[model samples]
Target chain A: MAEIMSLSEAVTANVNDGDTVALEGFTHLIPFAAGHEIIRQGRKDLTLVRMTPDVVYDQLIGAGCARKLVFSWGGNPGVGSLHRFRDAVEHDWPSALEIEEHSHAGMAARYVAGASGLPFGVLRGYVGTDLPKHTDTIAAITCPFTGEQLTAVPALRPDVTVIHAQQADRHGNVGLWGIRGVQKEAVMSAQRSIVTVEEIVDELNPRVTVMLPSWVVTAVAEVPSGAHPSYAHGYYERDNAFYQAWEDISRERDSFDAWIDRHIRNTRDFSEHLALVREEGVVMA
Target chain B: MTATLDPPSTKATTDEIMTVVAARELKDGVVCFVGIGLPSTAANLARHMHAPNAVLIYESGTIGAKPTRPPLSIGDGELADTADCVVSVPEIFSYWLQAGRVDVGFLGAAQLDRYGNINTTVVGDYDHPKVRLPGAGGAPEIAASAKQTFLLLRQTPRAFVEQLDFRTSVGNAEGGSSRSSLGMTGAGPAVVITDIGVLRPDPQTGEFVLTALHPGRTVDEAVAATGWPLRVSDDLTVTGPPTAEEISALRALTGA
Candidate 1:
């Protein structure tokens, strides 16, 4: 069964140094609070995994918390490049970060295989692309039934997976809707999991599209607006302006460090960080 | 200079003309797997103007998304709220895309070659790149699985390179029947829509041939912009200018 804990407590109890951690949310319901908590806790040498490593992963990579990143895409969404990620890969500003890249199909297949308790996932991908030359995880496999050749990627089994959701019942059953991404698969593929929810409800709403029974998750934390900047379907809208502003704020090393220090490190929690952002006029009131 | 031969009534920008031309490629009800930037704009424009029933699928797992405005990101909540249904990322790639349900894969490229192979990975070496681009998200599989693929890119000497820094998605491979030998299911990159004109692959040789030039864009200008020795079709034709309805609908959808 899962225990209801504080975000800080959940990170302290679950995440450790040198762990393969996945904070999965495509572009919506990203676990920004959990990522912040992990950054604040100063965990190091983590192999961060996500299909799209959005701003949260950018922050983590910039803060020098990650040693490796396993992702398909790393960008600022509608915005241009993720400067911090670029810095890490190009210059290795704080540390030497290694990357193992794959296409979205390959990454998704790896997760599916992990969730299904299989050794690897097969797909018709990377036939003429240069991706297979760079990554060792992708290989050619011949189908047993047919003579067709396919690509096989090893299953991704992360040490810990974190996600943000809309609600969690007292018994720690998590429920989330809107763009469901790979949160369920990530949770199932990991040895331990953390879910930060907007609220702890008496009963999960019937309309919830994805319901995670308590047994699968390790801990649950109630952190309202946990997916700020990113959006929870019914709770709030995506702060696109912030994402645009991040382009400038994260462009330089000094600016990114100062922003992180003032907003994430010095603050007590996500709410405090959010308040600082609002007070500083970084985000609209 | 070909300035004397240019038309005066052409008021539409190159991007607008390109988008309108690309939108015209989508049939009324085809399922289009859309990339984020230019392709998304074109697909949404098609929905708003002609192809109302054209299903737009984003790799973010929003299937049949009918957004009022073009989404900034693929997984914007607007896409989900307006989608017929939403699935997980794995399912979207596996059951929907790799399963061959998508008819047209519309994509944008950072760099492209004559064979239609894309290079969105890097601009230099893989281990040590001069410029690093966002790596392949879904282009490889989408290019390999969708019934046909459409690439949208602004043509330039830099982008239309003779040799790519990295090949992220395969169109026709080396030329001719190379894509077939690789066992890829889809008929790779049917047409490449650019700001200057449309380039379609030759039926006999898989090399992309400059089939049509947009109004006011000279052939010399197109030739000058391409890095490779671009081949022009034997019977080259001029692209029809964007109609008032196309410009108005595109502007309304983009709010530009």
Candidate 2:
């Protein structure tokens, strides 16, 4: 019972202002197109969630779509620091951004607990660590079986979970291969979800059984080359140059604003945005 | 192909020396949970050298990643394509890591203490940090759960601090029964491979004791770099320079 729709329509209907949204993908299959749509629609006050908030999250944060970021790490991978994220914390240029941080293990456990319909997640974490001092979400709980103590984090039940996959059937059965992080748990843990796929086919022959049946998915949008800077498994290669170029673009506030305004805000859709990137001779390979 | 050229007498950088020291610690068939950057280089070098069967797990859920070239990040797509198997992130942490299946956890940190507790979270104040570092991703769990750990870091007074600004990963946790009291299963940091040399925790005190120094680096140099009053082993060894085979393999893998 999933409806295939346009990325814009999906974002408008599903993602809303002041909602907690998780765009989950490790590095591959990042829903950059859907994130751009959220920026284009001018959604604000959203608490964006991801294990690692790479370029897309930087764009969303830079565009002033996010009021808070609930994540583990926020950086431009391999290149350097996320300047916009740093600016938001230090200067609060667009707005004051609240941050709730956790380790990758803690975040994954929280999502698993949420998907499992549990009240809280338990793990051996935050011991001899200062994360508990900064964030209220992480707490220490005593083990009932033994007299041992462990870490407890609240379940992450987001308002909407947005993810990108390689392909999905017309019936909305999404299949993602390669490095799939916590997309399944993210989708299942959310109240509603939007999946942007590279293609919609009759059936899937995924290398592995990393598929989401139609029952759990809410909407499927066909956005080819959706994970532009990030790569889709089989569609294309990662644009490492853009990741390096982002360091320069995001360093200055004016350059960051100008880049986002031209590439994301000015373009109509992902295809148009991609065309602009290519037409400008930005080397993807 | 017939004529063999003599090994170059060119000197290696401190970084290369550190890399060689870290890579030599790995044994054949060890399961290593590798962090990005320096640890990745060491783990891959281990594979190309003696530990060919060592399983390299990235936090991105790629188990046994066999990248033909070096991966830029743990989440790089190239890691996935090259990996033996890819599972969900939850499974990677829960089943492989937290289950104590990982033999060696290789990590890097901004700051470290005598007890081996690492601080990758912040530099100064927690609330208003002088430098807000990339928060802990999986290092906490990896540090606590892996059977043992190997740390690669540059030796400096600021980095080898007396007290970490933040404890992103617990090593001995003030040493003694503290680690066991916290329900940590790992044996804590086994060895810290720095540019100056190798430091291993004393069995009784758990304070890192300098056991070896790299060529041209003296015990005084190591002690000067350490923030705490560093102790030296009575029978310390000046570690042998990188072997010809090790250097060749490392150069081939890293292409530097």
Candidate 3:
């Protein structure tokens, strides 16, 4: 019995300051917009964790909210910059930042181990290089069966897992159109979860049967233009103009906040930016 | 391993320096967690050149792989068929990566900052990011836990940057020794390879210092392309461009 709530309310309720949270999507796909609202809600001293965080991560960390941030690698050349992330390093921000050296699959695999409640998930990502000596969190352990060595990654359970999808029913049956990796595992590994969707449909709808059969979802929030800025594989066209603008803002560390304040923070409706894109249609070079 | 031995030069276009600079980091018997693209190409070269026995592990269960050519991603069959062993993702991490057994972790970056934090996230706001990247695959652990991480990239203001949009992976963040404080005793990033030259982390600051530049390149050019005030080693030297033989070997191996 999941109650439908506003995208913002659901996010504010589930996410708090400094809580270990996992957001759905790979780079740019189905990340919960409501999650961003949660960050904008002004929770501070949080430890943000992800495989590779992009603009959403940048905005949150830049806003001085993150206390300790952990992940693999990040970048966006010819358009955006990691100014706040770099400043946190060059000047050393109040937050403690840890850079785990592994691929996106490696991190997701760790989450899979976490969801399974295993002590540590064995992985095969970095075998020959120096990536192993960086930390003992994910260390190489001996295989009792094969007597061969392997890389063991510890399981991850976040405080909250926020996700967005194509559709969901009143009972919180999620329909993931096309998500990469084990996103479901990430949600299961969380203590609590929130989901946003485009439309509320009947559980017996044809779309549900073809795409997702809702059984493990908790709640659903409908956000029409939610994935507006981020194109949905085949749903809409990719926006390049917005990317260029973001590139400009991200490059200027000092002024980035002002830019975020003007565009991201200033707007009340998340759909406002969608209108800009619709009118301009993504400006491609 | 010996830089002085000049291999015969091969004639080709598309600027082979990026491939050559990346290939120079390989060492025999060393474990390398290789990401696809340029990093994979370089790791393969290491196997063919000096480190014929270098063990390569991909996310898709391949270990000690000697691929004929670089695959698009780790899932490519070349990694598994050519590998000496193929283990599950979790088993590999538990047995090799997390236990601190790997030697070199190779990676590619979309955005990087001064502290060595990387980003593979969006370019704008969270609710509405501009461009979404391909996301991280296994870079988090590879960047943090490897004995040392090597970043292969083309030198440019665009690639080398002041900061990242998101911290996708952690790499000696905060400072050089702070990783140790966080209970990380693994060797941090030892070197970063680019088209121009090679950069090493300073012992104390953990910030990257320019150690070598290409034959016709200048220190100013390297500095100009950096995202921050670039650091230089006390004994910097000009690196010789790849010889004709090295290029031929690289191309023939790549089948490009």
Model 1 per-residue lDDT tens digits across residues B1-256? 1122124533788889999999999999999999998899999999987899999999989999999989999999999989999999889988998888999999998899999999988888998888778899999999999999999999999999999999999999999888899998788899998999989999878999999999888788889989999999888888899887787788778887
Question: Looking at model 3 chain B, which ten-residue stretch has the lowest summed lDDT?
Answer: B1-10
Error of 1 at A199 (Å): 0.7
Which scores better on TM-score, 1 or 2? 1
- In model 2 chain A, where is the ten-residue run with the lowest total lDDT? A202-211
Per-residue C-alpha lDDT of model 2 across residues B1-256, encoded as one tens digit per residue: 1323255534667888888889889998999999988899888988988789999999999999987667877878778878898999999999999988999999999999999999987788876777767788899999999999999999999999998999899999988878877778898999999999999999987889999999999988998999999999998999889776776666677777
| Candidate 1 wrong stretches, greater than 4 Å | B1-10
* DockQ-derived CAPRI band for the predicted complex in model 3: incorrect
Please give the CA lDDT of all the candidate structures: 0.92, 0.89, 0.64
Sort the candidates on lDDT, descending order: 1, 2, 3
Give residue B98's lDDT in candidate 3 (0 to 100): 70
Pick the lDDT winner. Answer: 1
Which of the numbered candidates is closest to the native, going by highest TM-score? Answer: 1
lDDT of 3 by residue, A90-146 (tens): 455435454444555557677887778887777544443334554456676778998
True contacts kept of 1: 0.89
Instruction: Look at candidate 2 and tell me the lDDT of residue B6.
Output: 59
TM-score of the candidate numbered 3?
0.57
